[model samples]
Target: MPVFGLHIRILGVALAAFVVVAEVAYADPTPDFFVLLERAKAAPRISAGEAEVAAAEARALQAEVGPNPSLSLEVENFGGKGLYQGTDASETTLSIGQLLELGGKREARIAAASLEAQAVRAQQTRNTSDFAAELAVAYARAEASAELAKLTAEAVGLAEGDAKTTRALVDSGREAELRFVQASAELARVRAELVQARAAEASAFARLTAFAGSKTPFDSIAVSLLSREPRATAVAGGTAPAVAVAQAESRAASAKVTIEERRWIPDITITGGVRSFASTDETAVVAGLSIPLPLFDQNRGGSAAARSEALAASLRLERAQSEADADRRAALAGLAAASQFLSAQLEVERASAEAYRLAQVGYEAGRVPLLELASVRRSLIETRRQTINIRLARVAAEAEAARVTGRLPFGE
Candidate 1:
């Protein structure tokens, strides 16, 4: 073949390959609910919580270490005049001193630090659960938006068909020009609505992908989460993450009080050394002990403050438990109501769909007016929209219940 002909053939082959690849990519299935949840776990906020837990654990380890010993050297009577001057009258001592913690101070400190670490871990758990619940709600919204977009697209198709039929009737002198105008207007309106619904669907998917820490936006989900029956039906009886966090904090505060109560017991420092006398060229062993007297600073105010904080923590823990219980009950009730509403709406949607079919048939047969057909179509669309909303509401309630019960919104 000529050079120009060969170039054209190569370009055509490349274009064909590109088309095939695009088709395969478009046919790829979207990620499922569990995959999205796993992606969410890798979000920055969740990673930050994990880092906090690790930091708390490191601090707990540091608390287990005791105070270090000190080494000191002292020289006296070396720079004075006459009898106290020069090296002949000098005295030197070298010593090692260690502070001995008293009244179980070290033990109390370790306990308090350990309890604080536990509190941090509990808080991290709460953060993860809360984020998961939020992600679940976002997923439901995205799925609902996609469904709405599909429904509106179908409505547009129906409107287009009605417009075409009316145009034909007008041309045949069977329908008035006003009827054709109305049909064209309805088609335009539904097309506009379809455009808006598609935009909303894209926005919802983008938000969902961002929440999941995904760099690539998802075009659609593998399944409709709102359409699936929620699996979280068990009563919320377990200790919620919020309650667990509060309980850990309260225990940590009580441990702090114990540490403060023991603070008044002074630590003892024991020193052992060798003393050298330059005047007689002699060396002697020496030992000493020191303790600080609690004359003014006995930690009385500190103990009182710790007690107050502990009391406050206890109250907070009580409130958290009560609130968790109440929230769980409310979530369960809301889920029940939403499920009932969804069931009733589904029935209405079915009946309305059948009514629209009959209206279309009657209108084509010249037995029904154009206005009546339009009204029936509007009713069907509204019923379908309400059903989608109710399904989303049910999913939200399920997610809330799962959050309060310290469980994943979907099954493991």
Candidate 2:
């Protein structure tokens, strides 16, 4: 397939799972995390990376092509002494010469260029995976921020009601003025927190939008902040992009080494044409061959550099594989930890909500002080915020794990 066709196919597959933001048709009116990833793939950074891959492919195609033949015209002996002074005394020749590559140089050139293109493609794939992971994390943070803002609004409302009740009780001489002052202060503090929470939500949304390079406003996300645990069978197999890119570079370097070594075999140029002797009115066929001597400058330096580069590439490949393995193990452990932490936060939030509800009832019945009720309410809000944060953390960990293992949230 053509290079442009390959680029189009790659972009299509990357963006296929999600609809464009302007064209969203979901019944629930919520966008998935994959949708954010789709947008991210269209971001400037990703497009530029893919463009580099296409350029590399184009260069490889150029490398596969042979050199063009040269056409030559010669008027030998025309400017020489007595006998060659006139045009009739000169012999004119017209010929075409083609350079023939020896020692498999053409094949080596093609192989080197092709392998370099492959390496570029591998790096592009790795970049996409990393960008996708970043998008997922940003989306999670935005959604969690929204949730926290909502919870904060709820706390503000509850604090306002408590302040009003405390004020009424103080006016009726049923509660101390100091208690009412404390309640007013708590209400003011909660109101200020609500403002901060909203600002945080806006900041998160801005980050998500910028990262995805979308002009459309992201009001809400539909993806679950607490994703299900990844199964062992879902881990991606074969070499990941990091390892594959290194291996390709090694192979490409090896091909370059071969190309440099082939420099020892000089290129041959074969020429054929017709020569005309004007004075005798005679025309004859002429054929010639030319080859350079490799006595000096036989590309020894280039060969040594290529060989060293190949060795370095081989070592990098090994290191990349080792790092990928270590990253995979670490990501899996983090995912498990985040999952357990989210579950614990959920339980704590549920218990806090119940306690706050009971505290409100007891306060209304005069069995609980206004201070205690206010304390429970703050605890509940804090727990709710923590729960949202933990859920976001779990989703981020899941994304990172998938990225490290070369797995997609949706099957690749």
Candidate 3:
């Protein structure tokens, strides 16, 4: 065969070997991130938050309804010695009283309740974002752990191969027994590491499954890096759930102040009835109105308390906005740092992998020492581990950014 053909065949064989190794390492397919997040929404915490929002909406709708008219029946001047002693001499009155709200009190109450409902909805949004963030982090952790385990498994394979070669050389008197012992020790160490890596992977998967509210065991997680925009542009300026909730609370508080002030308007109760006089067999229509006078307390304490609450709500809104801005900045910074580090780690991984390959080839030809080959293999493993960790961190930071900016990741 020509040299070029030999090189092509060798490359094809290497590629085929890599595919087989990868397939053997991970026989199970990984689940998508969005699917995991959707499952996470079924978690009990998130469901409880949804229920709270629904209850708040119901209350808000109830606030829009007016008070029901009250019906009363009375027998006036009854049981008196002369005119009301018996049923024949008694006057009976049956009436319905409708309380009419003044000073926009009904509107104010509805407005306050509506704002409160909005705040609850915002709280639900925040809860959803929090759940997404939790799932993202857990998914990343599971993915990283699995990848690390795979790398460790590969390392163990290399160490086993090295040990076999060392044993053969020792048996043939080409190498010392000490070298064989060292190679065997390397294999044992790598096997132990592989076991630990697998345990960590299992623990991470357990956490992901628990967070996702899944009963089935997940074999692996498939993670893809999100295409991020510029930091300043990507950090959305829209109202985050926390900030929206705070703002809605402030508006609701202001509405409550109006409601308290309107409390002094004194609702008028219009009573209309039919009066029956039993003795004369006469019936007459009667109408009356009642209003409470604001003599001692015209809702002065209520109004003052509402005003103070409104001020507190306003301050809380300001704080929420400030914290959201700070969170955005911090998440963006973490993403930038992790991305940069991941870029460097990629270069290191490529270089270390090639160098380890060359060292392995040299060791097979007796040109490189076994110790040198083992060191190169360890370096390659570390590089791969670091790369996985950095990728995990970058993904986590992106998820946090989406959460803080009220941008649901994966269009969720």
For model 3, give the 10-residue run with minimal summed lDDT.
223-232
Off by over 4 Å in 3: 1-30, 77-84, 222-233, 410-412
Clash count list over all predictions: 0, 0, 0
Per-prediction TM-score to the true structure, in the order listed: 0.91, 0.88, 0.86
Candidate No. with top TM-score: 1
* Cα lDDT listed for each candidate: 0.84, 0.78, 0.80
Q: List the residue pairs that clash in candidate 3.
A: none
Candidate closest to the true structure, highest lDDT: 1
The digit string of per-residue lDDT tens for model 2 on 29-141 reads 23776666765677998999999999999999999899899999998777667888768688999999999998899998998899999989988888888887777778778
- The weakest ten consecutive residues by lDDT in model 1 span 20-29
Instruction: Give me candidate 2's TM-score against the actual structure.
Output: 0.88
**C-alpha lDDT of residue 292 in model 3:** 89
The residue-level lDDT of candidate 1 at 258 comes to 96
lDDT of 3 by residue, 1-412 (tens): 3435544554555454454344335334347877666766778989999999899999999999999999999987667786668687888999999999988998999998988998888888888887887777787788788888899999989888989988988898888999997887777677666766776776677667677877666767554533333243566567777898898889988989999998898889999999999889999999999998878879899999999999999999999989988888898788788778878888989999999989988987889999999999999988888888877777788778878887765342
Model 2 worst lDDT window (10 residues):
21-30
Q: Could you give candidate 1's per-residue lDDT for residues 257-313 as a string of tens digits?
A: 999999999999999999999999999999999999999999999999999999999
